[model samples]
Target: MALKTYHGSCHCGAIRYEADIDLTQGAGKCNCTYCLKARAWTTFMKPEAFRVIAGEDHAVSYHKHDQAPVKFHCPTCGVHVYGRGDADYMGGPFVSVFVATLDDATPEELAATPVRFSDGLHNNWQNPPAITGYL
Candidate 1:
């Protein structure tokens, strides 16, 4: 099935983008420090599935601690939009989309989808099967 398109942007609406994503593809939750602090629910999609509409220059990248993945955030609002991971792990130049940024996503839509949890806090990132609901 064709993925649905969702619009998203930074907190200050500086960085806007659209993502063609399968709502049923499942989302992810990580217990990592940044994830915890950001309180973000995330999802994965191919790089080609996303399109930045505006404010690309307002985006900043940070690669601290584990430099393998470079986190992208809106410099103006400090909102994390995605992360660019190493080619080996990402299978190419892919980014993990921040599910929280999908402002139009409904709770029912999210509930109907699957979700996976990762123990990133302990650096034990497990790729488990998709979950049927939010964590």
Candidate 2:
């Protein structure tokens, strides 16, 4: 698929951003606790590919269990939008955007693409599984 432009924001529109991504590559939806709870769908992109057009101050971060990755969220509405980490953990030097937050794309647009599931819940680094049947 060709690369497409997308725009998204936090709940209440406090934080807004845009990205150029290839939806055909899809995203990762882990069964991890936080992921399951938030129902986060993620797509990886280089940090430079994503731009925070507004509300940078409203953004807060969380790091757990010594994991170098830092999850960024909107403090006001508590939306887990994306994250950045070491090259290895992120599949390279990139930030993984929560596909759920991309406002320009509809759920159908997301469902139409392929997604690879990483065993983030089990903390398995190698051999990540492909998730199926998730809406």
Candidate 3:
């Protein structure tokens, strides 16, 4: 599970960023309100592992709730590029980068990466949702 730099951006290409992601750790699918609505398929990384390479000003920030992460996206394209959050169980501050936003991930890379599910709708972060068919 070696970390590799992944380039990502928004639908309008207004927000560009780089993140050191270890795909082997698996991408996440959560049934939480926000995640379900966003159809978030993301990879988690330490805050230090992510950096904005361009379009900082064009990135619009949205904080859904106190516990929910501060999400950054492009106002023009409205793509949920990434988000920042803190969870003690996840080892403090972290960034969740949307896999769909990756500008240079090969099909093989994605096929090899695993998918992890969580029951976030019920706040049971440790367990997979009872019905992953929808999430």
Candidate 4:
């Protein structure tokens, strides 16, 4: 998968960022409480692959529980931009960037990428859904 730089912003343009990603790598869907409410389609990348270009001051962080990912959102429009957590947790130091925020994201590009569903609702990573509906 060849990597490419992509730009994105919150719905209200309060939070902006850029990421170097390989769209061929697909994205993730988790059934966790936060994810179920946010409905964000995300992909993980090293912290270096992500950069917050604007609105750090307006972004709000939410941690559901002690070990949950620190999900960041734009307070103005409530768009979930990304999440960060302990370097060792979930194979971080990584940032979970929501692909829907991409400036140029298209239905074709999304349809081309696979969606892997994780059973976060049950804390079961051992068995994830093998197939899911396209985004």
> Which model, 1 or 2, shows the larger TM-score?
2
Question: For residues 1-135, what per-residue lDDT tens digits would candidate 4 score against the true structure?
Answer: 768888999999989999998888878887767777788689889888889999988999998797677989987898889888665646757788888899877778878987778877787644565444522
- What shift in Å separates residue 51 of candidate 2 from its native position after superposition? 0.5
Clashes (N, CA, C under 3 Å) per candidate: 1, 0, 0, 0
Tens digit per residue, CA lDDT, model 1, 1-135: 538888888899998889888888787877767776777688878888888898877789888765446778998888898776755554667767798788778888878877778767766677532442333
TM-scores of all candidate predictions against the true structure? 0.81, 0.84, 0.95, 0.88
In terms of TM-score, how similar is model 2 to the real structure?
A: 0.84
Q: Write the per-residue lDDT of candidate 2 for residues 1-135, one digit (tens) a residue.
A: 668889988887888889889998878777666676778788878888889899877889887755546788998898887787765756677787888788989777888878777676778744464653552
Best by lDDT: 3
Range of the 10 consecutive residues with the lowest summed lDDT in candidate 3: 64-73
Q: What's model 4's overall lDDT?
A: 0.81
lDDT of 3 by residue, 51-103 (tens): 99999888888897787788888989999999999988788999999999999
Global lDDT scores for all candidate models:
0.76, 0.78, 0.90, 0.81
Instruction: List clashing residue pairs in candidate 4.
Output: none
Against the true structure, candidate 3 reaches a TM-score of 0.95
TM-score between model 4 and native: 0.88
